[model samples]
Target: MPVRFGRIAARMFLPKKHNPRLAVLLMIVATAFIAATTLFAKALGGDTLGPPLHPFQISHGRFVFAFIAIASAVAATRPQLTRPHWGLHFARTFFGWGGVTLMFASVAFIPLADATAIVFLNPVFGMILAIPLLGEKVGRIRWSAAAIALTGALLLLRPTPESFQIASLLALAAAMIMGVEIIFIKKLSGREAPIQVLLINNFLGVLIASVAVLAVWQMPTAAQWAVLIALGICMALAQACFVNAMARADASFVAPFSYGTLIFATLYDIAFFAQIPDWITLTGAGIILSGGLLLAWREARLRQLP
Candidate 1:
């Protein structure tokens, strides 16, 4: 019986075969799960906490939950907490937390689909930042794709007096910060374990957000508490899946799959809020999708070259 139990445990815990396709699929599922969480957050609203919560307040709850979940997971996994590159970790944490806060704020103002679409510019920004920060070279193909993606973003924003919202600017700021986070992650990729990076950033995020929440603390209703807990678990799981997927495949291969989140977000919006995007939003989304796919293809092709 002892031997049989040992064999069973080994089978369960041992690493499985590497499969890039499976990694891509997991990334898509994780993105969809994240999108669903946003829908849930929107539905729960500020009323989940007895009083109507502001958008930032709901975001604070979500971050608190994420912190608890991630901390627990780190304890269970016993990952190496020591980071050789503390500076990169700190940079990533500051930028990542800011981006997350801004994103949550935008979610409160804009539809989930639109908000997600705007933030999707992260990859484009990543590509641009990589050139200067990482000393990476960008070819003509990438530049063209970046231009096209920017145009799509402009279409979504419209920039006209009727369409302007300072909230959209917040989204853009978040995207830029997210780009900084990505660049820092790339810098730290091989130097530290992914779990370490995740844990540190989440820990810092919780700490920073906690200070903010304290200043604007409000009691949460039982239902809001449940929603926050659920969101935290989902966010941690999605992050884990994303890390695992990236470990298994190239970023260029996995990045395009992240776009699946937009589709899921749109469905979530329609189902929960009965919100259908107008033609302009739809057009912009389509263009962004096209540019993202093209960029991914270009990256994959370049990776295969010698």
Candidate 2:
């Protein structure tokens, strides 16, 4: 049993052919890493160092460091920073920065799993936004899938008559902005390098967040500094893995598997915060995953029909 399990684990982790199975596995692992990192960030945010920076501040710092690290690495490897299209670069800058800011803000108020789940709605919003933004056709299947996914989101939110937390809305807005970011990235494909886009997005995020960090800048304790650095490194690695996985396969094939983050987030929440999601949250998550799978299948079928 041990040997068999080892072999299975090796197959899941090892880099090999870029088949659909491998792509799905990579995406799942990437999502798990991201979810775990989110929990780690939350834990670190509770630290008393640096005057208790908001999640947005921590996220901003992470991106600033990430930009420097990625830029240095790109310069060391590629030695070129020229972009073919400035408009696409600018679009990525705006969308990516705004999305990250809003996502971080939501994290400050919501549970790890809830925040992650809400952000996963990006694909659902992507389909809706694509019709108007990219002049793409949204067929009946896509429309239905979007509606089901949105319904799942509403169930998870379960807005009360008197309860109002703008953070929830911020998360939804971030997801929508992320959908737009993904569309723009698709537009930039073949015209710009992935590393270039990452650099531009991070650079802009840092510039935008610098003001906040300045206003709220407090010296972090040794432990807080360590966790901050670690979070930045994990984020960079996750982004690298995600980029490699996407490059190896079709987005439609890999995106659904990214939902595996929910599993990791739930585990981390349970282990770290002693939090267990209720049945409603679990049911809503299931519906969201189902909708995503349906959309992926539809896309795959459409790809094959041609």
Candidate 3:
């Protein structure tokens, strides 16, 4: 099922009206679902649920069930679709799959708070990537914001020899790869229906993840299976909410609110695993959030200019 080209195109490309209030609400909801997805991933990644699932297996389950969820939505809505841009879909799916796998891997070895905070660097990486990929110019304010965010990531890394976490590197790499995915996503945005994009992206993701997971795949216990399903459904919901939120309002208006994921993830960590955020986690996360908000403010300001 696909959405009508005319209606979706108009909403995506035409700046008819914007509802920042609704967008913020949707974004916050999306953050909760996203945090829940990671919480489930953490459960499956560690021994709490069962034998720790491989990152490949965890990500594969994510795509499989997420595709199932989106497919069900498409079946219900039955929107007419436009011709898809396959190249962009493949690029987006490839990086997205890789990023999520690495992210799952990272959370297994580090606190959810640190992993979530470090992955927040995706926006900064996206800004750097846009310079070459999208031919966007970055001024001093944007550069400073990126630097501040990166500094926060470094603090989370605990540069001291004894305290440093090797796993954080996985989260860093995930952020970079997801940043590249953002370039492809930006290319697709406004050119396709959000539902169609969701459908195709998840379909391709499942295929890619299935192939990769085969090498290390193992059977998940009953509890692990349930969490896997929950993880995928949450991811599907998160993607839908995020895309619809962007469709409703300016991204800069909605982007900063995505930081709600960090809050939710921290709370989940504490509630489920008693993993409290240390001073470094809280301080670094705050720094990263400040930089993200700064960048969002800069973007909003630039858009207002002629």
Candidate 4:
């Protein structure tokens, strides 16, 4: 029954033909949705919305509502699905949930722009992890990119004793865990339908978060509840758009546009939170984005070679 539902959803949502222009548009939209999730997370993590929710509780809400959203789509479309690789799904969900929880933890103490910039380090971490886990070779160009991105992350850390923020470490840790999640995502990429993967991943995330959040469970204020739902729906939409974009165009083409998330995150911070980034935040984000773009170009070049 579930498998049949997933197939219908995939047909309904997946692009029928390649559309590079549409793909770029979708990537941009996905970035906005992704950034919106963080904005909601920041709101729920802080006292302005209500009593601050613990990171676990925030993440739990993310999974629960996201699952509901995805499940509803599955039922509506009724797509058929292949059996999932449960082990891979479990590992992916574990790291994904952990990364989001840590990211939420950091936003409570730091600006959204700063936190979003640091999270970009995930691709670099994924590159490093690929070396050991996937037996993939990393050449000097990729290494250089990693170095540049790390330098940007360090600048964001504001290592000076007076200005240093301990909460930033949580964001750093989130990037590392999310990097591992990327590795799993790569493994699953060609193995299952994107809709199926998303459904199972969210389902597993809900189970894990439900267990972890039990210890820190607290009732959220009405506003927090609304923000949580918005966060989840935004995330579900982001995932759907991102997968569809990748299907429509080369990842190298679509991936760079994803940096749009940083821009949107900053704008949201300014519009709602009135947080203006200093030169450091702007410069660090640019440096990191440059490194990420360099790496993407390198991958494109490599793909062309063969």
Candidate 5:
């Protein structure tokens, strides 16, 4: 297992070539794995399993298992996560952990589709963050796109009697943090290997979750144990596939497939929770995606500039 994982890590760090078709295929599949990870997490925390776990405990277990997998991979491959960026790494992981903390809890309260869609607004947040973080310029068109995206979020947030959910708010909060986290990743990906970044991210998650999880931890039953393990495995695979996909393609090329998360989330919701998003959610999600696509087009154009 260690040897096999080592090879995976090695490939992650030093890809000789980029394959667009393969990258897209891998990303599409990775999104499905990510969707499965969320499903497992929701099951671990939901009433369907009886005696819901604490969000921190779930995070703790996730990082713990992910660490085991990643460590084993690195142990054999020996990818050194050395040479600086300590502050940025810490900042990125801090926000990344916060997103995990909130998103996990939010799933307990909201439908999967709504939570995932709210989180999907990360690109818009990324555009906003890029000015300071990446020194990237956004023209009027992109800023206008942001306004339309905000309107979409507001529409989803309309306080209808049966449709409004506080959990959706939590998810949005997580999504915003995730946006900042992605900006950090954009910086890091240029300087560090994917394995190194993932290792540090999970390592910090373990340390933070260990302390937080203690206050609310509960012993996992056998079935929950299996699901949690599956969650770890699924997430590790998803992360690996995602990093590889991004490494092989430009952000604009990969951005659209990221929306596959919505389809997978909706499918899982129907299969497990028997829920479907209402018109408001669909409409709002459409608007948000429109803005995100616009942002991607703008980014591609910027990259093409001489």
Candidate 6:
């Protein structure tokens, strides 16, 4: 039974051939699950308790549950926990932990749709960051697309003197850090197993979130438990899909589909929180998605050229 389970689990996380279509499909599914996780984070932050739960504590619960949930798969499937590339794994953990922390913190106070839209800025950053960090070249069209995408994010943020929001800045920072994180993941993806990649990040998140939560920890209610469970299971499965998607397709191709997260997130926001996006928000999101798609198409064409 154990062997069979292990094989089944291992098969799910293992990388497959380059299939842009399959990668897009997996990314679509991942976006939905990730949107739900964001909603749960919002719920936890604004629960009935006199003081809302700390974002760090919520982050802790998220990874702790995810780590526990993935344990069965790891025990049954992976031959080893630690890999040869310890340095890369630790670096990934550092960047991933920072990104996740900021992401959760953003959702706790911002509208889900707004937060989701801004995080899609990673592709723009990824394209630009690649030149320096990964020593990759970017053509003029991609550069134009990056500029358009940045403009779109600014449109979505639309900071006003009277209505400035720190959450928006946090989301942008999360996207920037995650852009670097994605590049690092690409560096390691071909060399490391996807499951172990996820495990390393989640384990580190559990450790970091645990220590940070100690300053503002509170007991979880039953409802909060359900939210955390959903966060854990959904994020674990979502991360698997995302990692595999990137491994199988160009990051640009896989990236634009992430804007689909905005759609799902907006729906979740409306359905759960009764928050509807104003015309400006919808307009900005549309521009953002267009820019992201443009970047993806340009990157894909570049890859096909040589």
Tens digit of per-residue lDDT, candidate 2, span 1-306: 333332332232223466776666667778876886677567656644444567666777678766666665565455355645767767876787678767767766667777777788888787777788889887899878877877777877768866445677877888899988888877887775666666677777777667657776777778777777666656665666677678668877787677888899888888978789878678777777778778787877777875
Which of the two candidates, 4 or 6, achieves a greater lDDT against the reference?
A: 4
- In what order do the candidates fall by TM-score, top score first? 4, 3, 5, 6, 1, 2
Q: Residue 186 in model 6: shift from native, Å?
A: 2.5
Separate clash counts for every candidate: 2, 0, 4, 10, 0, 0
User: Model 3, clash count?
Assistant: 4
Report lDDT (Cα) of residue 71, candidate 3: 76
Ranking by lDDT: 4, 3, 5, 6, 1, 2
Model 3: per-residue lDDT, tens digit, 1-306?
123322332342223257889888889999999999888888898898789999999999999988887777776556788999999999999999999999999998998889999999998999999999899999999999999999999999999989999999999999999999999988997898788898899999999999999899989999999999889878887887787788788777788899999999999999988988999999999999989889989989998999
User: Using Cα atoms with residue i matched to residue i, what is each candidate's TM-score against the true structure?
Assistant: 0.87, 0.84, 0.92, 0.95, 0.92, 0.87
- How much does candidate 3 score in TM-score? 0.92
User: Stretches of candidate 4 above 4 Å error?
Assistant: 1-12
lDDT of 4 by residue, 1-306 (tens): 434433444454654588899899989999999989888888888889889899999889889887887887777776789988899999999999999999989988899999999999999999899999999999999999999999999999999999999999999999999999999998998898777888999999999999999999999999989899888878888888888888898887888999999999999999989999999999989899999888888878887885
Judging by TM-score, tell me the better candidate of 1 and 4: 4
Q: How accurate is candidate 4 locally (lDDT)?
A: 0.89
> Which digits, one per residue and each the tens of the lDDT, describe model 1 over residues 113-173?
7778888888789999999888989999898888887788788877889887677777778
The window of 10 residues in a row where model 2 has the poorest summed lDDT is 5-14
Q: Report the lDDT of model 5 for residue 273.
A: 89
Per-candidate local distance difference test: 0.74, 0.71, 0.88, 0.89, 0.80, 0.79
Off by over 4 Å in 1: 1-15, 44-50, 54-56, 80-82
What lDDT, from 0 to 1, does candidate 3 have? 0.88
Instruction: Please give the range of 10 consecutive residues that has the lowest summed lDDT in model 4.
Output: 1-10
lDDT preference between candidates 1 and 4, better one: 4
